[model samples]
Target: MKSELEKREILLESGTNEVEIIEFYLGGQSFGINVHKLREIVPYEPEAMTSLPESGPSMKGMLLLRGKTVPLVDLGSHLRKRQVENSVERKVVLVCEFNREVNSFLVDGVNQIHRISWKDVKPLDDFFTPYKPRFTGCITVDGREVMIVDLEHVITEIFPEQTIFGEGEVEGAEEADAFKRGSRQEVKILVAEDSNIIRNQIVSILKSSGYEQVTSFVNGEECWNGLNMLKAEAAHKGQDLREYADLLISDIEMPSMDGLTLCKKIKTDPVMKELTVIMFSSLINEQLAHKCQEVGADGHISKPQIHALVKMLDEYCLK
Candidate 1:
């Protein structure tokens, strides 16, 4: 069978608001990751892996691939679920990239790819509230449900130092501090991010930086509904939506409705069109940057760049 990553690339346009997911199995449960993040799929070779000392349990070890040493993460172990027995020799490894860093995830097997609309993927927040559910969203494929793995969160958990506000991560600490002191504390900001850890971190960062009036939602759908409610209230009070929420910072890979779709909707709507929308995501590459622009996003920032996000907020919202 063709490896999941070996399938023909789906020719999705820049701003069509669609994604291709590579489904795989771990501990008998179907899970998926975005195809765009995948580099390739390789057969797992335990003999080829070099064990690391003093690493996390999920950090299986490192594997040399194409002249580079890549860390290997056991997906099942990382999820704290039943481990995929190494005795079963025919295991699969998925090589993926995020925030310009590459890593591999070990899984039981690879399934075929599926192209789906962001609308089909439902956020876990609709069902429950947990710190980290391991999976960001769930999708139904041919009567079977598949959970989308929160790969970025997984990697961050393994390497906490990669977090946005980790030590020595602030690019312009002086300027950021100045902006926070000089900025208006009354600026209402709406943040839409599915990852609970990231959402809370962003909220905390914004609050500490003087953005006191901040509201957060888990996904674009929730954010959109919240915006609609605010719009209704603004209309009833004969005030602009900006008076209620001046800016929106959203992740691009959210479920129900992605950030690009949200930006497009906000920009096209008469009431919310003027609201400043910033695309904040790990998937913000050159092509994705163009997509953000095509969807009417006012600004774009790559992930794990808290300082840059702050700078953008100051430039667009504080000014």
Candidate 2:
């Protein structure tokens, strides 16, 4: 195992807006995930898996490692491709941790890591919006197109209750909803999110909570531009951004700009710095949270925590 100091050294400094992706192969196609999402690659041991009775097909089984129960997911099966099954392949398991959970993904082989800027990652077109495409984005690494797996969506598929801004209320949500119906909240919010489904859900939640002034952008770049537009409009009219928007909620990963860059830009601004900035994503962890803090995020919240999110709203927006 790599020592703690060695692990921290491997991590890039905050607000660089770059990612180290560990590329791997499954069914002869290239796929990758953020290195921060990865824990370690382990040799596959078929005899160690304990099968689950009612689990879905893509779920291979569970493995007990170092006093932790880690689920194993078959990358090929999940992607619905089986090109490697009949061939002579040496499988390896990529143990990964994200959103405060760990799982092992079975893949055909591994490749070298690639360091690239987040701006280079291209978002998929809107045609994929109707279907739940399990990819964050794709990047061309040395002329090879590598699809970055959306492991958050993969886990959500396996556990439907944990959707981003997802399913049934989180206990106090009912009371919060009741309170929302009884009052009017004039909070103006700006949101930047990449996923269409998740984006809509957030808008829906905010509207349901009596927040009428909400503006959303597909990615951080667009959000930044929107803020600039507000700035320009305010400058020309001698108004203030305070009259337009009060806060910003941004997701970490996006096509043209990532959340760290957005937060850093917002904090360093003279006038816009006063706006409260909250960073939210499905990939929030201690390491990423520390990075968010370094970039001057006022608060960091993970996805699907309706109750907690509402409480945060109460603290900053409602109180």
Candidate 3:
């Protein structure tokens, strides 16, 4: 029987159900945030705020919501170099629990919700050299282009002094118990990530989930080559290609060919099209999720709650 996680993966890749969405406008473009992170859309009243000193040019000010003060960041200023000029249409978008923190974004205006397919979005390359805050991915809504904001990236950038890496240790003895009890028959996961630390963290998490076999690659090109090689080997050995790789997990931004290109290659190739693929990215956006769907990805996940990842895997891969 397919695991629950595998079932969800199957449902996602096969184009089965409805997904949540949030619509907004920026730089004359209309975009949407995943309903997962969207908390609520509130009217922006300039009078209901307190400014934080030394919070940089983009940090507009703070709002006292129900007695607690929350910082409201200017989304346009951070991502597209556009400012949230004083206007009646602008509103504060409350993004729930990014990096485990409650945050709000200031936008030019709020648009209606878009019932977009998981397959219609794509991630935009950070052609912006050093990259900017709030930039995650982009998609088209009602014939207008909109950028999906990376709430996690934005929160991390704003609070650089705080360390979000909790009790960081990899494949340590502490996880052995979980590995023994929860793991299925060892499954192989092909992981492609650019950063060594992040890669190691992902590896450790997968291992803890009972995925005994994992092949880690630094970039999408290598991952593609590796998968092809594995496929060839499996054919030679008369083994099933599905047995070699239970899933493919990757990061979007990499050195050579990005994750989107890799996903496109894998999905287009008949030899590997059935392989379950999930994109695990720090860059959160509906546009990237849409692109993943376009190229035939199984699903998309944010690196917000690392622990929640295990639950995701269990729900999608191990049932």
Candidate 4:
């Protein structure tokens, strides 16, 4: 097993930057998935036997590859229409990996790979609206718009029960010894974010701040699961449920359930009604904060603000 230091080094080497994508057409619009996550593209052969149930509609069905059975969803249907019309030249199945699990989706046609940087991506206002939106942002490819979908969100949406991490605690327990002795009170924090990059950074920041007992989750569903686990453990110990996680920090957008909805649910639940919930995200504005407040969030913080995050942790969580 690699030590914590070694693992951290490897993650640092994989810098977050431009993602190479395989662009494809669905519903006459273009979409892109990270080439790093895509394994291959197979032509949609009519002779291929599909094992998907007649009632199953989101993903068309399953395809046999080698000895493994992979579920295939109609990419076009996921975007808009249900009955997808495919031509011989356009019909193709996109084989991609999600959460280390390989799955396939049928697309109308494939386009050439285009290298787009993170700086070129811009957020979609449609996603912030009440209506369900798929893509996180749009990247302009040769004057045309290409939608960038959040892969983590889509996968977790399909499989809510899948655990993001195991029960084994993170290593480097000794590295946190210095934090325990510090005069600063340990902060009780719960983070619900879908992105790995942001989650790791926030966790790192909190750990460095002498804060212990931090709990994290990828989406709202996982947050609920964690809360239930914490509650059950507390009951077993005969401890107050409020003595568990101190504060709730969540992103605005997520899959399986959004942060806004999660905050409302937490506040409405009789057992967890008093926890402090904050909406921490890059999408920030006075109007958005007001919207978060409406959803029962105690406060809001803009993203990439490490200093602000530390300060907030001290104020709300440390107190």
Candidate 5:
């Protein structure tokens, strides 16, 4: 389960723009996932799983791992790979947690954890594959290329009920809406999120809550460039960047640049230091919360917690 890279203790400092990706195999192809998403790994035991009737093709069954009933999803079947479920493969279960939910993914085997910079991970989208949502990007390790799997996208497919941004989160924000309507038209928000589905979800939620003046970028690199352009015009008028934008909503994992590195750049720059930066990422657990603080993020919210994000916007922007 461990490679030479994983043999030693790994200490990654906050805001360094580096990431650890775990390589795993499925149907003879290698895939990568963020190391932070892993809760634990265990050998797959067919005798331990209780089969359920009418389960989806990808759903193998549910397992009671450490007293928690977690659904096991077959990564190979979900990705439409042949000879995976019945093939002679080294079965392993990767227990992963993200967006405050736990799920295990069945894979052939896991290789090793590789330490790489976010800059090296190139954004990849293959038109030939129908599972575009599961494809996040690609990274080269040991002279071999591996596709980075977006677990958020995978879990969303398995449980579509969890993706909805309900209207309940906007009910109490009317008071702030009143103030905003009287003071301005809409709050100018800059969002930097890579996933199209999640980015659109956030934008839809914001517009539904009456915050319509939102600008979105695919990654922190593009967002940062957009800010510098905005800064130039504001500088010419002897104004700060905050006057033009209310706040920035950024995700921690992206291709060219990550949120923490982007936040650090913004906080350290005198021109953009006053602007508020909020981290809205799946990696915002208690352990990783301090990294947000280290990068000078004003606030941090976990993924799928759209209600909390709405409230934070009310307190920070509308108020």
Candidate 6:
């Protein structure tokens, strides 16, 4: 039988701005995760997990599945909440793949999947502190709001060394710096990412890499509005939109409007189509990459590839 992820991937057509999320529970709170990230769901077996020495509180240990060892993270512990007493009896592990890494999260129980438009999802940054790491957005399903987990952020916190901008991970930083300093000061890049942490990190990395003229928005709708303002300004000055912005770097899964929808809108527009569009997202895979190409995106890069992103900017924008 096809896994839920595979089935959903096949059912979801590209550029539709829709997502299927797997709703789950942890500490009596509802949570959601994009189905594309899920590899499979398995019943939790205490014997299957081997505890690691000196592991963090949330690091439940490693699980051996099909000759592969995957780390297990306790979702309840990470949220700093006490799970229900009978959680273990109904526990399940959500095995997910992102940024070419596989990990599993232990949750209290699994609920039904939901298919909803990206517009229904709302950014949580406006209501929460910038430091909150667990949730990226919220969506109302069946009269209740389900908070979506920022799985990438959780994994990054667990393994800090895996960060893309960490020292020694960025190749050709000097060259990228030189390009930015020498002739790319006027190149404006617009970034759209819903997660405040990821968005700030990306902006910081870009500025540190010497790309100073960068503007950021919390979601695709904001980005679209920003682009329109730039268009209006450019038109008033009798200049092209490219004069105001050279490229757009967008996250795939965002509230109000998705990156693919944003890219499609840009490509479909007469003037906006001239600007280069790069899908910078953790959701990038063979299927999603094809979607980017279909929407006329100039390129696609997986999340946490700060070095490669700078290199691309140097080669494409600076040149």
What's the true lDDT of residue 174 in model 4? Answer: 34
| Per-residue lDDT of candidate 1, residues 1-319 (tens digit) | 3343344442565445678898998887788999877888889988889999999999999998867889999988888668546635588899887786889999888878898898888756655455345677788998888888878878878998776556445444434566565564868899999877789988887777677789999888899999999999999999878789989999998877888888988999988999999998888776678878988999998887887887788788766
> TM-score ranking from best to worst?
6, 5, 2, 1, 3, 4
- In order of appearance, the predictions have TM-scores of 0.85, 0.90, 0.56, 0.49, 0.91, 0.92
Write down the RMSD of all candidates, one decimal each. Answer: 3.4, 2.6, 8.8, 15.9, 2.7, 2.2
Q: lDDT of candidate 4?
A: 0.65
Which pairs of residues collide in candidate 2?
Answer: none
Candidate 6: stretches off by over 4 Å: 125-131, 175-180
Tell me the tens digit of each residue's lDDT in model 2 across 1-319: 2353237534777777787788988888899988777778788888778889998989999977777679999877888867755653568888987766788988888887787898999876787664335998889988988989888888888877656655555434445565654443678888899888788888887777666578999988899899998998988899988888888889987778888899999889997898898998766887788889999999998776765766676678765
Report the poorest 10 consecutive residues by lDDT, candidate 2.
Answer: 1-10
| Of candidates 3 and 1, the better by lDDT | 1
Tell me how far the alpha carbon of residue 76 in candidate 1 is from the true structure, in angstroms, after superposition: 2.9
Off by over 4 Å in 3: 1-20, 46-48, 83-90, 132-134, 161-187, 192-213, 216-236, 240-243, 246-319
TM-score of 6: 0.92
lDDT of 3 by residue, 216-263 (tens): 997777898899899999999999898789788887655455676788
> What is the Cα-based TM-score of model 3?
0.56
Per-residue C-alpha lDDT of model 6 across residues 153-173, encoded as one tens digit per residue: 888888887764576555654
Descending-lDDT candidate ranking: 6, 5, 1, 2, 3, 4
Better of 3 and 5 by lDDT: 5
Candidate 5's residue-wise lDDT over 95-153, tens digit each? 88788888899988888888889999976655636766787789988788899988888
lDDT for 181 in candidate 2 is 40
Among the numbered candidates, top lDDT falls to: 6
> Which candidate comes out best when scored by TM-score?
6
Using TM-score as the measure, name the better of candidate 4 and candidate 6: 6
| lDDT head-to-head 2 vs 5, winner | 5
lDDT of all predictions, in order shown? 0.82, 0.80, 0.65, 0.65, 0.83, 0.84
Per-residue lDDT value at 81 in model 2: 68
Q: After superposition, how far is residue 52 of candidate 4 from its true place, in Å?
A: 3.0
TM-score of 2: 0.90
